[model samples]
Target chain A: MAINLKIENKAVVEKIAKLEEHLHLQALKGFFAEVADMTMFTLRFFKEALKPRYEFKELIKQAYLIGYKSFPLIAITGLIMGLVLTIQSRPTLAEFGAESWLPAMVAVSIVREIGPVITALIFAGKVGSGIGAELASMKVTEQIDAMEVSGINPFKYLVVTRIAAATFMLPVLVIASDAISMYGAYIGVNLKGDVTFHLFFLEVFDKLSFSDVFPALIKTVFFGFAVGLIGCFKGYNADKGTEGVGKSANAAVVYGSLMVFVIDMIAVQVTSLFS
Target chain B: MKKTTGNKVKLGIFVSASVILLITGIYFIGQRQQLFNNTFTISGIFKDINGLEVGNNVRFAGINVGVVEDIQQVTDSTVKVDMVIRDETRKFMKKNAKAIIGSDGLMGNQIVTIIPGPAGKAQVVDNDIIATAKTVSMDEILTKIKVTADNAAIITTDLAAVIDNIHAGKGTIGKLLMDSSMAGTVNDAMVNIKQAAGGLNQNMTAASHNFLLRGYFKKKEKKAQDKADEEKKASEKDKK
Candidate 1:
């Protein structure tokens, strides 16, 4: 009896190990499969984007929904970011007797990095999830299929328009956010100290250059494209009905936000190479 | 339809405002760089730039007048810097004006400061090479500070030794201040000196009263009296 029990225990352990190996292999396969699908999706996007019958009306609508609607949140966050950064940075700079450098330092920080990145994250949370859930629900309800059956190109009408609007509108939003953040920084500087508006702006412009502005603006275009593409890809391919919609939205936000940082890292590396 | 139109109008306005803001920002930065202005180029040769890069401000009379446009290594030891200054500033900048690389603050970017030349010199023309003075770099200042700090450390060490010696009553000042026995001896000497001085005074009185010294004392008294009388006569004449 003792010998039989030992053999059974060994067999069970072997089975468990095999199961674990199988699960890891499945995960690896799924990751590569997803990467392949995403590549195809991106290629399709470029192809459709460059093709003739452009969806101007839909693009305009998406821009309004994505860019204009996202402004209030972006603006509020921008103001807080600027104010908090200045307030927090003041103590350290003051220790070095460099409080006068507040405006120029804050301006470079916001224009070069914080303004585009934070705005893009907020945009991903709002628009990425919204696009993901909307298309996911449409997919589950067979609306995409119905449109296709009725001789309409749903992918061109839905996906390309959104991606294009996102690519173009993000830079504009970032510019507005940067301006508002500068005002916030000015207010912050005057909270504990006094600097005239003229001098404040002069210091800000003194430190800024074409290199700081142009590369930051260009990267937002990529950040927007990533967010929109990820959201659309997740939603358009969703399955399993109502459950799929929730999963798609959650994954969209997660992946979109992730892609923003990844793209940012690449952009910084590329910019540094040129600089 | 109405809602769509309204949304479009709002979007248009927002886009326009954002674009305007961007343009305004660009304009300000450009203006600081002497871009979109009537400008002229000038160059200065310096022994070392001390990390002054292109696009650093060129300040004239404490106001930003231009930007550093280019920097080239002219020799192993000298660098030539090109500046784009506004044309309007030409009258103020003279041929003998000197450019010095300075910092914006204790911790700020390097700037080229143009010190105006003496009046009556010719105005600087475009592409003119101006003289440059070697401004002190932070490393040099820090090196000087380190030397001072080292001297201070040595002085402090010596001072501490001197204080220790005084505490141990090793030197004259130390003995004067810290030795109780010496202090008692000094007190006794002071008393003896006082007694000696009193005896000298009495002896001098006695000596003045002696016959031979009496004549001398009497003569001194008479001379002092005559001097006083002459002074009184002089005052009377002046008053009259």
Candidate 2:
């Protein structure tokens, strides 16, 4: 009976020890593995990007589909973003009797931070899922293998073009969206007060410096790259089933958004170092 | 194939429009900073900039005509600020133009205001070191405000005490304002004054008509009549 008790006690201790190890070490282990995988994937992207087979024509097509197609939605979103932000910010600035500063304040808020972030998030939701599901469906149907057997460079045509399109197109979209949003802000400012278009733009230009603009612009490029890369990574590695398609689409948006915020944080820190 | 070309053209227009929009924005912002404009550089040495930064607007005659391009510490007590003013505004800036750091509003960013010098002075040239006036910093203004506020507080407190004294009927003014006894005293004094004036008038009238003074009064009347007669003759002669 004593021997049985000893064995039971020893087993209980071992179980607790195993539980502790899982709790303490497993999370760190998983995180490091994820980081390693991400780094390797990024390296693969760089390698694939420099590959010999060009996909210029496909890139233009994808650009049309991704950028041109996304404009109306992004434009509407941008307008709403500027209008809502201005309308919402009025009371706070009014409290300080700084209602005249509306143009500068709204312009800085939109151009520096909100325009790129909200647009990138929207882009991730729309384009990320679209790429993920399309690629995932192709993978599940073994169409990728069929293309490979048929002697076409599928990655160059498929992955590279889409990624490049997203990478280049986002900045264009952001620029357009920012301009439209400023126009929307002008309307917002005029809703309760009178400000001519000329004065409003002058006020905006007065406050915004190159430092305010260029860093924000450069970060959007990185945001575009991150969103596209994460989407491609998730979709291209999807399992060969219909369920994998759904998972890929969902993970694509989730990871893309997560990485956008992650990249924004890092970008802000680095930008602070310069200015 | 035709549809593809059409789509490509549409895409091209969109891309070009977007790039144009970006360039236009950059141009305007750059123009505000005197980056694209033909500009003339000028430097001012200030003891304190009062938080004036690079890219802060430099106003001339209440118009933003330049921007602060650089700020560097020249000495322990002096900071040199380089400015780039639009070439168009250069003609208005006199060689003796004074740069004073001022704020946009009561609570806005610091700006350097260029006060035009004497009208006869020559126009300022490029790279000229302009004169700088010692500006009152926000902290200094706040300190002055605090002192004024303190004085106000003391005055208000003293006023309150004076008001309380009036309410309690303490000082002469307090008594005048608040004391019913003082009011009655003033009323009695006024009545006494009125009686004294009446008595004095009576005495003067009695004295004027006294028997001893009757002769003197008659003599005075005769002299006055003679003078009136003489004045009348002179007036008649002048009229003639």
Instruction: Please state the Cα-based DockQ of model 2 relative to the true two-chain complex.
Output: 0.63
Off by over 4 Å in 2: A1-31, B145-240
lDDT of each: 0.94, 0.90
lDDT of 2 by residue, B1-240 (tens): 898898899889999999999888889888888878899999999998888898888999999888899999999999999999999998788999999998889889889999999889999898999999997676888999999999999999999998999899898888999889889999999999999999999997787799988888789889999999999999999999
lDDT by residue for model 1 (A65-143), tens: 9999999999999999889889999999999999999999999999999999999999999999999999999999999
DockQ comparisons of all candidates to the true complex: 0.71, 0.63
- TM-scores of chain A in all candidate models: 0.98, 0.91
Q: What is the C-alpha lDDT profile of model 2 across A1-275, one tens digit per residue?
A: 99999999999999999999987898999779877877887887778879876877788999999899999999999999989999999999999999999999999999999999999999999999999999889988999999999999777778888888899999999998999899899999999999999999989988887888889889988888887877877788888779999999999999899988998999889989999
- The residue ranges of model 1 lying beyond 4 angstroms of the native Cα positions read A1-4, A94-97, A190-196, B1-6, B152-240
